[model samples]
Target: EKKDKKDKKEKKRSREENGAAPKCADEKPAKETRVEGAQAAGDVAARKAFLKEHRMTMEGNGVETFFPCYTFAEAKFPAQANEAIQNYAKPTPIQAVSWPVIRAGRDIIGVAETGSGKTMGFALPSLPHILGAKQKLPKVVVLAPTRELAMQTSVEYERLKVNQVCLYGGAPKGDQIKALRTNPDVVIATPGRLIDLCDSGLCDLSQVSYAVLDEADRMLDTGFEEPVRKILGMVNKKRQMLMFTATWPDSVERLASSFLRDPIKLTVGSTELTANVRVKQTVEMIQQYDKDKRLLALLKEYKVGDNSRVIIFVLYKKDAPKVEGLLKGRGYTVGALHGDSSQAMREATIAQFRKGEIPIMVATDVAARGLDIDDIEHVINYSMPLTIEDYIHRIGRTARAGKTGTAHSFFMHPADKNLGWHTAKVLRDAGQPVPPELEKYGPPAVKQVEKTCNISEMAPAPKITFDDSDSD
Candidate 1:
């Protein structure tokens, strides 16, 4: 008995030196563990109180486990955290609240406007979960709605030295299959291609412990809900799930209930279709034919510079190339991105835009949701989006990382009148001026003019006889 006790003591000391969990028999006493847990609870309470004092509203069960961090220095792995902070300066509001919740190993639903640093909000917390794990299978799977977003998410993981594979359509699958053979630690992919890989036995999700649904709303909008649901079902049910979106529609709410287990919901601001407050919004009422000229004038005001990078969004895919040509002809370096653009072209365009080789990018809604580029000073809506949600996302391309930006929207009368009411409401909520034509469509006003004239008010005219003179 004496010899066994001595051996156990030495074993516990060795494990401590090696940074391993202590053996059950040598673990701390239950009462001591409980006391430490109580202290942690108290610390979280204090942090929540601080958030409340700052007017950051958060609500849900088990939210006390989440504590906001003012800087990356407060992170669990400060070295890794500092890498991101060095680029972003500090955490945004969403990142500040989300990091702790995700780090606490609880499911979370994060809703914030575009350009709020949501990518890092989920990425930072996932690092610790995946870093030391065996690379036989993916431990983290991030599903994005578009290829651009998936690629961007993968880049975030790469910056941290985390091994990752991005799988999406439009690109050749042979490379992706070869990447999967290496058994990466993370898989960033679109829903359709992920499902195809899983079905073909080229990938596995049974061991996936962390799953993130980025741009959840857009996923549903693009008819990816079925594939997303299927992928979720294949993953470990005991895993931690994180759902992030710019807007929370009924579809996304349903998705959360089905996949997430007792999620804590966090919203950075009012739960409505709203753009970042830092974006100065302007709505110009112009004729349809004059939109190109108006866009030229706006672009002239914001030339290529360190702080003058811009994204111009068109409503249709066909318009993207046309706009690109028009801008290039006007002596502006520009690139186009849309659904029809080949994967190689899209990648080259995005790379050029990121490096400021092309200071302006003309794109469709494909670039609206998850393309994260820094220092975008302006977002020009050459054509109004079909929905107010899309409009908010389009303008969100600017005003990112707490930096101020400008959004200029061309609202052609008659053509864009259908969206006038919703557009006016969004502008009003943001405290921006509503064009007179759009203001007429606002609440408490008539959206359409009723051209009515009563026949009873018409005056009678006397009949006159004319002489037949020059007919012959």
Candidate 2:
């Protein structure tokens, strides 16, 4: 009995030293007491200092348990950490705060501005969890709102040497199915195609350990709320959830309550609708007919060098082709991207644009959310978007990675008057100059009404007498 007791104690001590919980019933209480005492004293101070240093706002239960990092070396994945240090040089604000929370195995709702390195914020932390997992089904599933974004995410995963299969609607299903047969570590997909594949038994989420909803607000806006819910239901219940959005609306909060289990809300900046301060926004009040001329002029002014890139955003997908054609006719090398473009054509266009072979791209809102190309010089809003949220995303195409860029918007009077209030608010928030005409349409301005006197109550006969005499 003495030898058995000594062996048990030695086993418990070994487990404790290895960072594992003590399994012996007698040693468990002491282990818990020590852990609680240490946590009560050190954890709070460390978390407070980290939050203040990073200028981050965190709200949720047990948020103090996670640590923040100044460099990727302190993160979980050393390989990805090395890659980030060597390639990207340093972590962005979002990455610096989010990587630690995510790596600590906590569900997080990350709210950051566009072009704030949100992809790497979620991607790097996710790698260490799913990289070496052995399972027939994918361990990590990243849902994007658009095919382009899904493909872009897949590229990021590949860069980290994390084998991933992209399943989006525009691509060929046979290729995706073949890729899935190999059992990739990560599955980057859009909601519709992912749902279709899961229903058809080509893809399975039963073994998914990590689920990410990238651009969560945009997903809700694009009518993916139901599909997202359905996909979430199909995944394993005991999975880690990460949601990222540029802006947080009530809908996102509702989705979080429904799907997430006590998630930590990490907002890097103001949650209100605002554009990046790095973007220099200008509004040109012009007639609808003169938009073409203004676009050409702005292009010449902005797109000066061979490496300079410009993206012109239009409201409708049909307008993308027309704008591309018009620019081509004007001796500009340009390409168009919209939902209607074939997958091959869209990929080719983006590749050429990225390589600087085609310096201009005409696109709809499909390219607004998750298209991350560095060094884009200008974003031209040839036409105003339907919503202020979309307008913020449209201009966000440029001014990425700490580089200053310009956004030129052509606003038509009376037609764009309804958007005037919201547009002016965003402009003022970004510290840009709001046009005087547009400001008139903003709030705090009351219209003057002409008050009429009651003609029946007035002495009208005296005034009519001269007219009657002239008529007679």
Candidate 3:
């Protein structure tokens, strides 16, 4: 017995010296047990405390064995990937806990609001996971809702020295086919375009072992459910799936049950529809006809002509160009991002906005979901979105990367009354003052409106109709 114990100790030391990955205390299956550094078995109390402090609720078969990391060093990713992660001051709450679970080779369902550094949370783990696979066999595939988000995810993988090919609608298909011939390690694509390529026999997902569904809720909401399901069906059966969403809805729950196997659900904050607390929300009850003047006044009040960046969110594609023309006529350097813009135009506009050359951008909900520019100082809602969920995502564009921002909304009665109660609840939850005009649309006010209109109940809010042409 003494000789056997000595031999095991020497083996462990040798493995450590050679930088082999560590296994969880209670080992799982072959691919489902490797973690970064060995977690301290006695740190159960501290791990529980960390989860509680972040308001993170996690539950699954092997979730209790997971622990949180305060720094990237604890993640101990391969040296090539470690350098990029170390550049950040510290991991965001979602990234901190998700990395440990992901590195342990478990499928995870991350429920966190936008601008929570979710991209890096999943991107960082791809390095170590792909290192063990065959050379350029397409080990990883990330399905995003929009082309902008797909490109953003590709940029993250590029930073980690991972060769990637982006497949989206708008770009030249010939160029994409050529890149695919190179057998890139990663493919970040939109569902529709990816399916098209697969049907054409130019791309193969047979060897894809790591798959990610980024912005999955948006994919379902935008009428891409069939495409998403078809693409998932083509990938390897033994793959690990990772899904991240801003809200936890029944639709997402059903989809998760269908594809994921014994997954861990991690919710960083409340599952209710809530905007980022760092944003200061202000509602102005004004006339619909006077909105153009009010927008100009708000622009002057916020001094957007200065170095700060601002995004003006409109409701429709037709309105995006009009708003852009209005801002440009007033001598403001501006750009427009919508479904109507060509791929090159969208890319150039986003690049200029990121560089601060174009300080103001007129955009619709297409820019709302996963557009991650961290320096936006303000958000001006030119019109109320059809749903409160979209309103939260619009404002989420600002106040990113630990910075505070302001959001101004023009609320016109009869047009926006459907969202009055919903808007007030979001304001109250964030501790922002609720205006009396907007407050009257609460439950009691709903009754008042029903009584005056002589109706049994108010009609539900109008549903948002998305364009099916641009799947991204």
TM-score of each: 0.82, 0.83, 0.85
Q: Which residue runs does candidate 3 get wrong by more than 4 Å?
A: 1-38, 442-472
lDDT per residue for candidate 3 within 382-458, as digits (tens), equals 99999888898899998988789999999988888889999999999889999998777745342222112211112
For all predictions, the C-alpha RMSD in Å is 17.4, 15.8, 10.5
- How big is the positional error of residue 242 in model 1, measured in Å on the Cα after superposition? 0.2
Query: What clash count goes with each model?
Result: 0, 0, 0
Name the top lDDT candidate: 3
Ranking by TM-score: 3, 2, 1
Model 3: weakest 10-residue lDDT segment is 449-458
Q: What is the Cα-based lDDT of residue 59 in candidate 3?
A: 60
Q: Summarize candidate 1's per-residue lDDT along 54-166 as a digit string, tens digits.
A: 33555555554456676666656536656665766667777777777777677888888887778888887887768767658889999999899999998888777777899
The positional error of residue 320 in candidate 1, measured at the CA in angstroms, is 1.7
- Write the residue-wise lDDT of candidate 2 on 286-391 in tens digits: 9988988888888887754467899999999989988989988988988898989888999999999888889999999889986889879999999898888889
The CA root-mean-square deviation of candidate 2, after full C-alpha superposition on the true structure, stands at 15.8
In model 1, pairs of residues that clash are none
lDDT of 1 at 281: 97
- In candidate 3, position 295 carries an lDDT of 92
